[model samples]
Every structure is written in C-alpha cells, then in structure tokens.
Target: MTIRLAILASGRGSNLQAILDAIAAGTLDARVVGVFSDRPDAQALQRVPEALRWSRTPKSFANRAAFDAALADAVAASAPDWVVCVGYMRILGAAFVQRFHGRVLNIHPSLLPKYKGLHTHQRALEAGDAWHGASVHFVVPELDAGAVIAQARIAVEPTDDADALAARVLTVEHPLLLHVLGLATAGRLAESAGHALVDGQRLYTPLPLPLNPT
Candidate 1:
C-alpha cells in the first residue's frame, strides 16, 4: 500500500518539498494527501496540488482544543497514515497528541534533548557547542521531548551564526526527514528499548562530531 501522508508547515515548504521529491523519485513509498498550516500565507500550502485539500484555520479558534480539532479534521479528511510536521510552530495539546499517538512525526532544527524550544541556533552558538544539527522524532505532548528516531549533526563553525547554521542544518534536515519517513512508511521504524529500531537494528541515538554531510 502506498503510504498516505499529511504535512503540516508554518513557513517555507523546503522540508515538504523534500518529501514530495522523495515520493516523486520513488525513493519513498509515501504520497502527500494533504497540506496544512496555521497561517494562510505559508508558502508550503502552495506546493500541494489544487486537487488536494489544504487548509488554514484561525490561530485562536475557540481555543487550542478547537484548533486541534479543526486541524485533525483536515488531516482525517486526507486519510493519511502519518502526519508529518516539517516547520509547524504550534504546541499541540495533549488531546491531539493522544489522537495521533505513534502516527505523528516532527523534525526539529537542533539535536534534541539539547535545545527543545526556539532560538536553537543562537543557543548553540551562545553555549559554544562544537556541533549542531537536526532531529526526526515522534511527536509527544512534551516540547521536542519525544523519543528520537534519528539525528544528523553538523559542526558549528567559528563564523557560524543563527542564519548561517540554520541554513546548513536545514540541508541535513531535508534528507534526514525523507530517510526517517521512508523507514516509517515501510514499517521499518519503531520504538524499542528506548531507541528507534529500523529493520531490526537500532538507529544511532544522536549524530556525533566530525559530522557527515548526509
């Protein structure tokens, strides 16, 4: 069966595009059934075909629950097997988290368990960390605290700032998202023994120094 996917984004659709490209090239067995955003002007929404359903609801719908309900409704209409958050900036409520459970995935710009929230690049530079990168993980109620699936790290160069590092990290993020999604769509990724197991093998918990470009 082809994997049906719903992608949520709040900014440019670079990550969304990566998934689309993967599917187009037959590297991933997934199809984007829907695209959604909180901001109607989000560029990602434009990437979806006119035939596919896309929505942008009020950010302050009755409340967070109402917003989640609206978002869930849009997602369910697509009948997707997975909901992937590329650059979505909302803090999903617990109810929404339980509804999706293991079927939801998210990509964070920084190696998780390190910088859970925003300003990650700045935080990394401020802390003087040698390496910084991205993570693909299951979406839980906690902010970027879910069980990690995979991570791609890049060295933080001396001249790196938020914008420079973010751009570099995004390069790694695009492919990492596709790789993790491919595993998920193939039913080869799962949580086991506090780590993500793929094809009966444990994926590395985090990317280490002397980072690889992939």
Candidate 2:
C-alpha cells in the first residue's frame, strides 16, 4: 500500500526536494498528495504539480490559532496518512498537532533536546559542541519536544561557522529524512503511548542516521 504523504514547508524546501527525489527514484513507496506552505512565495511549491501545490498567507488570519486551523483544514482535505514538516517555520497549534497525532513528523536541524528552537547551528557553535546533526521526530505541541525517530551525527570542524555547519548537516538530512520515511512506510517505525517504536520495540533513543545511503 502506498502511503499518502503531505508536506508542509517554508523556505527553500531542500528536504521537500529530497522526498520528491526519493519517490521519483523508487526509493520510497509513497505518493505526495499535497505540498502546502504558509508563505505564498515559498520555493517548495515549485516541486509539486500545480494542482498539488497550495499556499495561503499567514497574515490573513486574525491569530495563530485561526491560521493553524486553516492550515489543518488544508491538510485534512488531502486526507494524507502522514504529514511531514520540512522547513516549516510556523509553530503548529495544539489542534493541528492533535489532528494528525502520531502521524505528523518533523525534521529538526539539531540533534533535538539540544537546540529545540531556531538558530540551532549558531547555538551549537557558541556552546562549543563537538558534534552537531539533525533529527527526525514526532511533532508534539511543545515546540520540538517530541520523541525522536532517528538522528544523523556529524563532527563540528574547528573553523566551522553556522552556514558551513548547516551545509554539512543538510547533506546528511536529505538522506536521513528519506530513511526515516522508508521505515515508517515499511511498518518498522511507529509511536505508541507517546513513545517511539521500531519493529514493535520501544525506542529509548533515536535511531542513528545513514542506516543506508540515499
């Protein structure tokens, strides 16, 4: 059974592109039913067919909850089995989180529980962290505080700035996100009672990335 996937993105949509590439290459057995963005000008919209692309301005809404409600409605219309947030800058509301529940996934630039919010690479650099990477996790209501599915680690070079570090991390992120999605579709990855599970076993820690090359 092909998993029906919906992607919400804000920005360059590199991760979105990665998923599209994976589907095109027959690496992932899923179909992207919709690609949504809060920013009307988001480049991610370009990756999908004209009918699958959707965009709405956040400014039109009176408040955050109202905006999220509209966003949730848009996602619901697609009837996606899974909702993936890739470079989606907006913080989702509780309603939206509950709507998708365990089916909603996000790819954060940080290893997670480390830099939960934005400026992850800069913060890691300032903290003198030896390693930095990305994590694929469930999207809970409290920021990025959710059970991680998998992570990709990379050593931080001595002279690396935020941009340089982000570039390296992104290279791993593209493949890592696809790998996690593959697991989800294969029934090897899941969440139960708020805990992440792999092959019906509880996942105490997130699975490490590069399990297989993209």
TM-scores of the candidates in the order shown: 0.91, 0.96
Candidate 2 per-residue lDDT over residues 51-138, each given as its tens digit: 9988999889898889899889989999998999999998888899999989999999998899999999999999999889999999
Q: In order, what is each prediction's RMSD in angstroms?
A: 2.4, 2.0
**Which ranges of candidate 1 are over 4 A from the true structure?**
192-195, 200-210
71-181 in candidate 1: lDDT tens per residue?
A: 888788888888899899988778877777678889999988899989999999999999889998888878998888888898888888799999999888888888788
lDDT of 2 at 98: 93
Rate residue 181 of model 1 by lDDT: 84
Give lDDT: candidate 2, residue 176: 91
Residue pairs in collision within model 1: none
Question: Cα lDDT of all candidates, in order?
Answer: 0.83, 0.90
- Among residues 3 or more apart in sequence or in different chains, the pairs in candidate 2 whose N, CA or C atoms overlap within 3 Å are none
